[model samples]
Target: MVTNGTYERGDLFDPNCGTRLILDRIGDKWTALAVLRLQHGPLRFTELRDGIGSVAPKVLTQTLRRLERDGLLTREVFAEVPPRVVYDLTPMGRSLIGPLTAVSDWAEEHINAITTAQGQYDAGS
Candidate 1:
């Protein structure tokens, strides 16, 4: 498809492949946070921005776009005075429950120890 006289490869480990494309979508700074924010229920754009703490508006918009493009979140636009928009997880996104829950529980259980380790590492550095 190019001057290199080569076609695209489908292998994920190829470094220039499409298989890791999914990771590129959801493995960023804000996609997971957006998903976690939407887990409770649907939220407006402003609410989502506030829920995720200090993320900038531009970053949040980009994150939401990536999630929507990947079919993980649904965005609804309402016809109203201010044209409200809401974000919610698709069923596919909800399917992430088990893994997220497991990770959350594990984090809760060992947070103290993790904090101690971080403190030690910080002191060393």
Candidate 2:
């Protein structure tokens, strides 16, 4: 028998399914920035931090680890005295760039509309 908790086919809205898990992983402020940075090929840990701008090192490390664990990025460590660590987007992460860009453009285009709608909502309330 099929379990109710299972996603089966073509069911992405299931709360505990892989799709939801991925959504939870990537739906964060830092994850978006991290993905954007990795879109320009791979970068060392320090470079990622700089590219993202002002994110604390600890937060950046945690974000990268979460993304890596979720298969959106690959973290590589070079064998050396201090060890060089780099992050690169996986195919999954690269696939997100175009979509994210469209989302960004949409937000830019609709800022006025959204603000107006919010104002209307507040006035109605």
The TM-scores of all predictions, comma-separated, are 0.76, 0.76
Clash pairs for candidate 2: none
The worst-scoring run of ten residues by lDDT in candidate 1 lies at 1-10
Give the total clashing residue pairs for model 1. 0
TM-score result, candidate 2: 0.76
Task: Kindly list the per-residue Cα lDDT of model 1 for residues 37-103, writing each as its tens digit.
Answer: 7889999999999888999999899888878887899999999999999999999988765666676
Return the TM-score for candidate 1, rounded to 2 decimals: 0.76
Poorest lDDT segment (10 consecutive residues) of candidate 2: 1-10
Stretches off by above 4 angstroms in model 1 are 1-19
What number of clashing residue pairs does each candidate have, in the order they appear? 0, 0
lDDT of 2 by residue, 1-125 (tens): 13686645546776545666666666677898889888989999999999889999999999999888878899898999899887899999899888777877888999999999999999999
lDDT score of residue 113 within candidate 2: 99
Q: After superposition, how far is residue 38 of candidate 2 from its true place, in Å?
A: 0.9
